[model samples]
Target: MRDPAMIETVAVIGLGTIGTGWVARFAAAGLAVRAFDPDAAQREALPEAIRQVLRDGGHGEAAEALRLSLHDTLEEAVSGADFIQENVPERQAIKADVLGRLDRAAPVDVIISTSTSGLMLGQFQEALSAPERTVVGHPFHPVYLMPLVEVVPGPRTAPEAADAAARFYERVGHVAVTLQKEAPGHLVNRLQAALWREAVACVEDGIASVEQVDKAVVNCLGPRWSVVGPHMAFHLGGGKGGLRHFVEQLGPGIQKRWNEFRTPDLAAMTDTLVRGVEEEAGGRDLNTLQRERDRKLSALLAHLAG
Candidate 1:
């Protein structure tokens, strides 16, 4: 549980998909949440969205525990917040603007963790006068349910800032993976992008359809990956020799596969990919699909916990 003294109140600076997820997670942890967004429609819909996310993720009771307030201005939302989660668009300019305002308004000691998946923190932390307090708290989708939060430090970030961010995330039911050194895309995203490039290549080469690609992961890679990462999986593949033996046997093949990887021109295949994905969706609207995804994910997480 979040210590009231440390992070009882949180400010969410944007109301996009990721921002809403942060609010959902923070609220579910019984934190006092104050959110601000320029979009009137988003502001109006936020409360219900948080509720729905909580209910869908199997933490419905936490909805009652949430003490949420919406503000028209950024400053109002951040006032007295012990921690801030910035969810602005991925663009450096937009992030710089919002974070600048936050840096000016938020308490100097408060942590300003962002939701950037790829951009390194040094690119935008310039706006923060207390740059040491700003850190990357990159999270995966359905942020309320996903346990992983990548915490990366910027060029000027104090080591303690990253530590504090990790502590805050842990308190809010997340596993904070701190990077030893800041990387451009961070760890998980870089790995995902590598696989994504190849997945796109498969479709571009006409070797697999979009649906088939998804099925390939679902049937093979997905299950094993859920239980153990690729390194450990390959280690087990060595049949008791571990990673060293596996690498010795498979390094050439792995290098060969990497040599063949290429990205498809996304624009050329956009229509086909979209159509194929729609077919895979099977007439289920986004809300239905998301609810089902979260439900299954919750079950999987519960089983993993056991």
Candidate 2:
């Protein structure tokens, strides 16, 4: 049975990949989900996508009992929702427009969180009457399986609202990472972009092929990263003395020795990246790749759970 005190109804304001994932997870958690998307195909395809997500998570029984409703209009979707998740496109104008609409339509006290990967909530929250209740709840891809949700509050967002949103995500099986203040690309995305930029630089300068870089990560850093984050991993790298010794030993020379690349022109490298990724795919289509990824991800998650 569903928890009596848990929020009963969730409103998902888009039906794209992230939104569909959210809908699946919510339904699996026993919340009634109301969703709206302008695209007819996305709406039509959602039921099966949801089934796949639940199936990936071993929620096949929940898929049968899933209480998911599709609505034609945003207003109709947000109606009676105890919480709202906005996953519209990443444009500032579009997000502002959708958020403004949601602000007007959603119950005043309900929190509205965006699935924006990097946009700061302050940019669009100003147009809303309930800006205090608006926040950023950015999740990684495959939201049902990924544990982290970066919860960022706008300048106008109330502290209590941020706290409440974090608690809600935790309740639904997410690790809520709350930032003290929102930055240019939030937290994780910015870190990822930095590494991605460096990777492009590496390829541009002939330091490593795409395949080599990927192999290095997969065979070396990625496994360690799965277990320990940068600080802890580096601290362990310090032998017996830990972070203080590591910093003392390597801190001064770090920037001068390692900061050697400019962000390569993405346009110039587009073809290179595409060809490299294609070669890496080895003729496997997207569906096959996705299934393989999800399978491995499930095994890893189960091991982590134990």
Candidate 3:
């Protein structure tokens, strides 16, 4: 684990959508941020976005006082950082090459984290010299709003490193959960894939429109998930029976349904078809849609807190 006292500077490599958000999150949590992006244009936008998000999230004065340093090269960015979060594109070969380079440049004490959604941390760390210090710190989109982060340790990772990583995320207001063992998709991806398969099947089978499918869960299940996860929700739902009672009564039905479930044929579904439905629901205006979703998520979070 990182020495709680020694942890201070944070470096974000490849300041794309997720990287920029990471900078905002760490900076908002009161850490000095060093950000790098090859595209100078995108790097230039970081300060303004960070400002707006902090202001919108009710930290206006702190946002104005936020200090963020932008660097041109990845090596320059991670030079003296205590932790380096890599957010490059998700191709294994590309990740291997970039991570190998970063490993050479960063200090031995710096912890390197990959933001790979489902890539195995052990596999990625193989390209690095001190693979034991590298870990997967995967965050969902809009990292600012979603506090849930999956901390996956490689096969060679030290418990101290994992412990330190978890503590850092929690210090920054994230609900960091360490996977007992690393696996593809970690936890959230598996849960999302299960729902995605069902949704795609429903759409392909003509059982519901895409809009209807999205709305069904977003309007109902989404709110619940924003607070408690599935297990706790079911525990409360079991009424007198609780979890054990639920398993005895509904477990068989679930197994039967699982056996009958079919995976969706992605090749059969065209982007045109998907976008056609999306357009019908005003999909062309992405900002409006994302804003609407964020508004709903914020409201739900506020209500849950109350």
Candidate 4:
């Protein structure tokens, strides 16, 4: 269980797509939320969206009383909050300003966390007075459902703060992995980028259609991933020999494949990706695509649960 000190009122800054969902997740876990978005109009829709998800997740009546105090200013948002989660634009300058503002405005004891997908935690930490309290709490999109939250501490970050944030996440039904070093994309995104690189190369080579590539993952690796991670999967695949033995035997083949694989510069492949999405889901409404993704993700979560 998480220490009570780390799991209290959570103030979420910037109510964009990811931020709104974060609000839902934290609020549903029964934490009082104080949220802010510079664009006042965006704050209007948050209540319904959060309530809808809570209803879907079967929170029902309690969802109605879920008090999300939408604030007009960042100062109001962080006032008296135990933890502050920044989900602002993905720019270092913007983050620096926000961190600076938060450091000056919020109480020094509050845990300051960011929802940056790939940005270095150190950059934002430098702007804060108490840099040691800043933590990188990166969560995937649709934060309510995805269980993974990478908890990274910057160069000057206090060990106690990182552990406290991890315990807080665990208390609210999240799995937190503390990264030992600050790196671009952290852990999962590195693995994701490696696969995405190959995926782009495959598309450029015309080896697999977009749908076919997605099908390959969904039908093959997806199910297995639900049971175990990539390393453990291959470990089991080696039978009695296990990973070390299998790697030794197949190291040459793996090297050969790596050399044979085409490498396309990712920036140059953005249009290719846009086209691939158009080809795979061209006419589908975004809601329909979301429904499909939600269905598969829900099933995967259930399988993992068992």
Model 2 C-alpha RMSD vs. true structure (Å) is 2.4
Estimate, for each residue in 1-306, the C-alpha lDDT of model 1 and write its tens digit: 223246788999999999998999898888999999999999999998888777766677887666899999999999989999999889978888888898899878888888888778897766568898888999999898788999998988888888888988888889999998789789998898889888888988889999999999988998899999998899899887888898899989998997877777888988988998999999999989987888888888889878
* Window of ten residues with lowest summed lDDT in model 1: 1-10
Residue clash pairs of candidate 3: 1-160, 1-161
Greater lDDT among 2 and 4 belongs to: 2
lDDT of 1: 0.87
Clashing pairs in 2: none
List model 4 lDDT by residue over 196-238, tens digit each: 8888888778898777888898899878887799889879878
lDDT, residue 208, candidate 4 = 89
Higher-lDDT candidate among 1 and 3? 1
lDDT digits (tens) for residues 116-178 of candidate 3: 996887886766788887889999888887878899988988777777888888888888999
Question: Once superposed on the true structure, which residue ranges of model 1 sit more than 4 Å away at CA?
Answer: 1-5
lDDT of 2 by residue, 134-179 (tens): 9899998888888889999889989888888898888888899999
Query: Which regions of candidate 3 fall more than 4 Å away from where they truly are?
Result: 271-280
In candidate 2, how many Å is residue 153 off? 0.6
Give the alpha-carbon lDDT of every model. Answer: 0.87, 0.87, 0.83, 0.85
Scored by TM-score, the top model is: 2
Candidate 4: clashing pairs of residues: none
TM per candidate: 0.93, 0.95, 0.93, 0.94
